[model samples]
Target chain A: MKIALLGGTGNLGEGLALRWGKLGYEIIVGSRKLEKAEKLASDYLKKVGDASIIGMRNEDAAETCDVAVFTIPWEFAFDTAEMLKRQLAGKVVISPLVPMKKVGDNFVYVRPEEGSAAEKLASVLEESSVVAAYHSIPARRFANLGEEFEWDVPICGDSGAKEVVVDLTEKISGLRALDAGGLSNAHLVESLTPLILNVMKRNKTGELGISFR
Target chain B: MKIALLGGTGNLGEGLALRWGKLGYEIIVGSRKLEKAEKLASDYLKKVGDASIIGMRNEDAAETCDVAVFTIPWEFAFDTAEMLKRQLAGKVVISPLVPMKKVGDNFVYVRPEEGSAAEKLASVLEESSVVAAYHSIPARRFANLGEEFEWDVPICGDSGAKEVVVDLTEKISGLRALDAGGLSNAHLVESLTPLILNVMKRNKTGELGISFR
Candidate 1:
């Protein structure tokens, strides 16, 4: 299956691209600018030594790929979804956006008016199936290709979309995919990012991730 | 140290009482009625075969014990704090309360007006140090004494009280306590309860606990 990483120039997108590329899935790096996406795709290909990964504009990538994953920051998530509404119809879209604000060296979770980023994205792209996952994994862990990801990725969505996302999650080595209820529970999943960040900050640790046992 | 479990008639309180009582801490089972507290204390003692665990009214327990832990439900938490404010003065108090409401088959985290349960309790008992921990542990895991708790408990509070709670947390076998920033970040910790509950519900699993690595 072809997977498109929307806003794929960031660390999160690059990391996922590398991992998925190594797993033999076709990867398309999507960004607002085609040149930046191409550059990151080139860098990821070099890192993973895979020549099959390609890069394109966000709209074009979403229109062509089977799965479109939003690895963008929370602030731009809704707007990007709105812009790509026409292209993402009938395709599975994933959200890893977490809304948080830094307050005096402490990060606080800011609940969006739509409850969560995933819920908002779902509303914007009414024809598309939106699944929320990968919200809790640290970006650094994703970028470090050598490290095994021993963390649970909780996914929430409608049944059909959720199954697809769960299947995709299991394809990644050392990661477990758990079905964590429906789309409404996305806030609970998104909120974990700041909580893990707080844990990492106070404990003086890096790449903090969670496992449910 | 003499540790008091306020509202000790509940499952969470009973579990902690058994664990700490086994560890040789003086356990006081506190409740609204002294008789109920006494009965639970007797049952606990019988279960653990420890005679030192005692029962008392909530106010008396707070006044006498070194640490007062509010293991009550979120609905009764604020009122109970108000009733015991004078007795809890200058003492270290722990809030494991998670504010959540069940909607349909799933539970959603409802943030209190004061941001989190711990922050609300802190505001009510201004003279006491409020520490929030153990928000994510499942009650069944705690009550089943045979199982070793291989989970990370993230704690948040002022420096002094936080250290005391961390020390107490380490006393439990196979449990690791890590500082999770200050009291302002309590919402992040409290919010994890419902997320775990949702995960358990969707996955058809039990005793789902988190470990950060």
Candidate 2:
């Protein structure tokens, strides 16, 4: 299947593109700047030594790709989602953005007024199926797809979209996709980012990750 | 000063007991059963070389010690906090418990209706000066006081109590305590636990903790 990564020049977007690219999915890196998109795709191709990945402007990429994932920063997440609504209509829009504030030793997730980031996206993109996944997964982890992760990727969205996302997640190999309830409960899924950071800092565990009890 | 560690038989409680014991603070391991408490203290001495630490029943430990730290599970967090409320009056009660539900490659935070775990503790013990702190720090990190951890500990509560707790945190040698805000905001603080777990699982960084940007 073809997957377009909107704002694919970013840390998270880049990591996902690398992983999905290796899994035999057609990767189209989307960026605000056409040149930036090309640069990201070229860098990824060089890293992977594979030529299946391509790059294009966000609009063109969104129109042609079967599914699109948004890995934009919190400040630009809503606008990015809104702008792509027309192209993303009747299509899947995966959002993994989280709202957070930095404190002394760590960061705290400032809950959005409309509730969690996924809920806000779902509300705005009422016409499209917005699946919120990978909100808690660190970009560094996604960069190394060759390694196996034994933890569950808690996903939340409409049932139909959830099925598609989970199928895509399973395609990555060695990663489990779990139905973590409904879309309204996205706060529970998205708020895990800062908690992970806190645990990493306190334990002094460098490059740390988790496995469920 | 005397410090009581409720559920001191566990990983985190044992770690804290060893660290504080080395710093010259009297340590008391509290458990439901007196025999278990004594065993934990013995184990600490065995692990870290003997110093000064005693074990007792939870209530008696609370009554004897000036400060109390509850390092138990989230399932029993409320009851444990309530049981020790009378003994905790005028003293500080620190909670490091997190509520999490595991899903595929991630863990979603099961947020309490009363907000985060710390907020629940404050509401349950409104008569006491409840300070929510060390919610994100890993127990193993604190277990070895000789190991230096260049990280920050976010703390929030009554002003005087905050200072006292901050002072106590500094005695550990390498930990820096920062004032995050107030007790009402404990939801944000307590929710960090699950987020950390999710990040760790996704990244495959074992025993990972948080660090500020």
Candidate 3:
């Protein structure tokens, strides 16, 4: 299936694109600027060696893909989702968005009034199937193909899109996808990001991923 | 150190009492009823074997101990903390309380107006050193002496009490203590309890605890 990474030029986007691209999925990297999208797409393609990957403006990519992953920075993601609503309608969308901020020496989850970042994205993309996953994956190490690690990705959503995203996540070696609960429970999964970030930053444990053991 | 477990009649209290009692700390199991406290203390002492473990009323335990752990249910813990405020003044207190509720099939964190359960506890016992830790430990499995497991406990606090709790947590076999910033950041750590509970219940994975690997 065609998968689009909306605002796919960041660390998280790079990780997902590289992992899925190498697995032979048709990966489309979407960005506000087409040139940046194309640049990162080609960079990821070179890293993957041989893969069906391309780059396009967010609107075009959103319209073309069967599935889309919002890998955008949480602050700007809502507006971008709003703009892409028509294009993403009736399609499966993955939300890895974490609304968090650094307060004093720690990172805190800025819970949206809509409950969580995923729920907010779902509200914006009303017709799209929004599934929350991949929140606590340490992107730097995940994007490094040479690094091997075992981590759990807790997923939450209301529809079949959750299963689709879970299957997509498990296709990436060394990652286990767990169905956490439904859309209303998305805040629990979303909060794990800031919790992981604060733990990593305070402990100086350099990009840690979670395991439910 | 004289360590007291306030409202120490639960699975979490049993786990801490057994673990720390074995470590040779003077373990005080406190409850509203002296008989209930004494009964559980004797049970824990039998399990721990030849260790310093005793039982007392919550008031006496708070006044007598150097450090106290609030293993009480979050709903009633505030009033208990208020009642014990004078007794616990100038002592280190650990808040393992999680304010949460099950919404349909999943658990959600009930964020207090004070930010988190730990923060709320801190607000109540203004003179006590409040440290947040052990929210996600699988208490049932933890209390089962035969059940061996590895887990990470992220701690948050504003003073030297954090170090004391960290040292105390790490002393438990198969557990690693991680500093996850200050007391202001405790909500991030507190939310993980419901996150883990939801994941475990929805996935039917039995009881699971977190490990940041």
List iRMS (one decimal) for every candidate: 1.0, 8.2, 1.0
Candidate 1: Cα lDDT at B145: 83
What TM-score goes with each of the models?
A: 0.96, 0.64, 0.98
Each candidate: chain B TM-score? 0.97, 0.91, 0.98
The alpha-carbon lDDT assigned to residue B130 of candidate 2 equals 69
What stretches of model 1 exceed 4 Å from their correct place? none
Better of 1 and 3 by DockQ: 3
* Predicted structure 1: lDDT: 0.89
Q: How high is the lDDT of residue B48 in model 2?
A: 65
RMSD of 2: 7.2
- Which DockQ-derived CAPRI band holds candidate 1? high
What are the per-residue Cα lDDT tens digits for candidate 2 across A1-213? 889998887767877788788777899999899999998899998877764689999988988888889877878878877787888888888878788877766667788888788888877777888888886565676676565555456677865988899898877665667565567557766766665565456546544343332
Which pairs in model 1 have colliding backbones? none
Among these predicted structures, which one has the highest TM-score?
3
Q: lDDT: which is higher, 2 or 3?
A: 3
lDDT of 3 by residue, B166-198 (tens): 999889899999998888888888888888888
Per-residue lDDT of B163-191 in model 2, one digit per residue for the tens? Answer: 78889887766666766566655665666
On lDDT, the candidate that comes out on top is 3
Q: For residues A80-129, could you state the per-residue lDDT of candidate 1 as single tens digits? A: 99899999999999999888999877788888788888888999999999
Residue A45 accuracy (lDDT) in model 1: 91
Which is the winner by lDDT between candidate 1 and candidate 2?
A: 1
